[model samples]
Target: MYILKKNEKFNIDNETITFREIRDKLTEEFTELVKAIVNYSYDKTLKNLKAVVREAFDVIQVCILILRKCHTISKDLDYPD
Candidate 1:
C-alpha cells in the first residue's frame, strides 16, 4: 500500500490505500511477525532461546525508557504541573 499526497494517484490490484489503512496493515504485519518469532523461540531449546529473550527484554527496556521520556517532555510542554 502506498500513501498518497495531494494530487497523487496510483493504481492497485485491490483498492487505493489510505493513511489509516496503511497504518492498520503495518500494525497487523508487525504483530504477526513478532508472534512468529516468539513462537519459534519458544519451540527451540532454552539455551538457544535465552539470548533471544534477553535481547528482546533489553529492547523492551529501552523502548519503555524512551517512551517515558517522551511522555514527560510532552506533559511538561503541554501542562506544567
Candidate 2:
C-alpha cells in the first residue's frame, strides 16, 4: 500500500525486496493470523478478534505488494502478462 511507502520502517522496500523475502514475510504474517484465530476461538474477546483482523490485513497487504513487485520482475523474466 502507499501508506507502507510513507512509513520508512515498513518492510515493503522495492529496492531490496525479493520474491523469497516477501514470501517469507507472508508466511510469518499468516502464522500470526492463525495464532490470533486460535486465541479468539478459546477466549472470544473483542481484543483478540481485533488482532485477527489486523493480522489478516497485514497478510493481504503483503500479498498485494508481492503481486505488484512480481509483475515488474516477471516482465524482466519475459513472462507473459
Candidate 3:
C-alpha cells in the first residue's frame, strides 16, 4: 500500500501498480482482520454489566446537566441486574 500510487510507475519486476489496486486488495483485508479481532469473548457477570450501565449513565447525566435539559432523566434510567 505504501509503494503504490495512482498513475505512478514502479521500476521493479517490470510491472506497474496503482493505488486503486492497492486499495481494492487491502480494503477487505483490513476489514476481515478487524472482524477477526472484533469477534472476542467477554466473560462478565450481570453485575459488571450493570456497573458499566450505571457509570455510562452517570456521565450522561453530567452532560445533560451541562446542556440544562434533563439531568433527572438519567436518574430515572435504572440498570436491571
Candidate 4:
C-alpha cells in the first residue's frame, strides 16, 4: 500500500500469504484504480479528488473482503475475537 514504506515489512501469520504479499496485492489494485481515475481526470479535465475517492473505495473493498474471510474462519472456530 501507499501507506507502507518500500523496505518496511510485517508478518501476517497467514497459512499462505505474508503481509508484504497482501500489501503488494492491495497496492497493485489500488494503483490500477487510481490510474483509472487519473486517466478520467486528465481526459475530462476533472479534479484530483476523483483519485482520492477511488483509492479509498478500493482500500475499503479490499479490507472488507479480507475481514469477512477472517470472520468466517473465526466463527467456524467459535472464537468471538
Per-residue lDDT over 1-81 for candidate 2, one digit per residue giving the tens place of the 0 to 100 score: 553543354445755687887788889999999999999999999999999999999888888887778776777886657
Against the true structure, what is every candidate's RMSD? 11.2, 2.4, 21.3, 9.3
Itemize residue pairs with steric clashes in candidate 3. Answer: none
Residue lDDT tens for model 1, 1-81: 122232122121122334454445445545645765686667876654665565555444334434444555567585645
lDDT of 3 by residue, 2-49 (tens): 222232231222123334543444454455444443442253566556
Model 4 C-alpha RMSD to native: 9.3
Task: Estimate TM-scores for all models.
Answer: 0.40, 0.79, 0.32, 0.46
lDDT accuracy of residue 74 in candidate 4: 80
Candidate 2 accuracy as TM-score: 0.79
lDDT of 3 at 79: 43
Runs off by more than 4 Å, candidate 4: 1-24, 30-46
Q: Top lDDT: which candidate number?
A: 2
- Per-residue lDDT tens digits for candidate 4, residues 1-81, read 332223223333334554456677678768877787777767764455666676677667556545654665687685658
Name the candidate that leads on TM-score: 2
Stronger candidate by lDDT (1 vs 2): 2
* TM-score of candidate 1 versus the correct structure, residues matched by position: 0.40
Model 3: lDDT of residue 73:
38
List the lowest-lDDT window of 10 residues for candidate 2. Answer: 2-11
* Candidate 3 TM-score over all chains jointly: 0.32
Q: For model 1, which pairs clash?
A: none
Q: Clash pairs of candidate 2?
A: none
